[model samples]
Target: MANRVDTLVATSPIKCAADKFYNFFKLNMNELVKIFPLAFTGVEVLEGEEGTVGCVKRWKYIIGGIPVSATVKIEVIDDAAKSITFAVLEGDVLLLYKSFKATLTVSEGSAQWTISFEKSTILTPPPELYIPLVITICTLVDAFLLVN
Candidate 1:
């Protein structure tokens, strides 16, 4: 089977300040998960401490009636650019893809802030089947930022 890499981008507008949204993802991800339990069932730190690159977090949640969990490591954190990148080491997407990396970014706008998720996944067996989950998470993040 040939490895296919796919990049999926999902953007959404938020009412909160760009910095707040950026920091939430970069620093307070665990607290955010607690605040929005509906979006994510639970998030546990599997290795290292939070808020720094190399920290790994395992996320447990349900997707389409199926219970899924994924362990992702913080790959890059650029505070100036308001971006964070996470590499999926195991679980969920790993069943199909050989590797996956997701980068989330927050940008300021005149009236509303925007959050974008750029997911690059290397598929092993072909056809992209897991992108909707990323989009759903981005949508949830967008709504969550606007409200709280």
Candidate 2:
């Protein structure tokens, strides 16, 4: 069978500063559950420490009103570029993809999200649904940051 590797990218303009938005994901990821209870149910540090490379986190988030979880490892953190990359180690996402990685990049006025993956089988659909999910999260976070 042929390898089905693909990438999806999406960008959204945010109200917050680039560094502040990046820091929220980099340093204060744990607070996501508390700040957005409807979108995220929990975020637990399974290995290593938060805001550091090699940290592993188990995230429980909502998709289509259903709760889904993913275990991911922090693969890269580029403060200069304001980007963080996460490798999905396991969980519901793995069921559809043989390999999966996501990168979030924040710039002066916007945030870009990229998802790279290899499908587990030809029958598996591309992760198109995640585009809106990430966009919604970005919009919500932007609003939350503006108010708080």
Q: Which numbered prediction scores highest in lDDT against the true structure?
A: 2
Q: What is the alpha-carbon RMSD of candidate 2 to the true structure?
A: 1.2
Task: Give one digit per residue, the lDDT tens place, for model 2 in 7-122.
Answer: 99999999898888999989987877877788889888999999999999999998777789999999999999999999999999898899999999999889999999999888
Clashing pairs in 1: none
After aligning candidate 2 to the native by TM-score, how far in Å is the CA of 52 from where it should be? Answer: 0.6
Over all chains combined, what TM-score does candidate 2 have? 0.94
**TM-score of every candidate:** 0.75, 0.94
lDDT of 1 by residue, 38-126 (tens): 65788999888888999999988766667788898999888988888888888976675667777777787411222222233432443
Worst 10 residues of 1 by lDDT: 110-119
Best by TM-score: 2
- Identify the runs in model 1 with alpha carbons over 4 angstroms from their true place: 110-148
lDDT of 1 at 3: 46
Steric clash count of candidate 1: 0
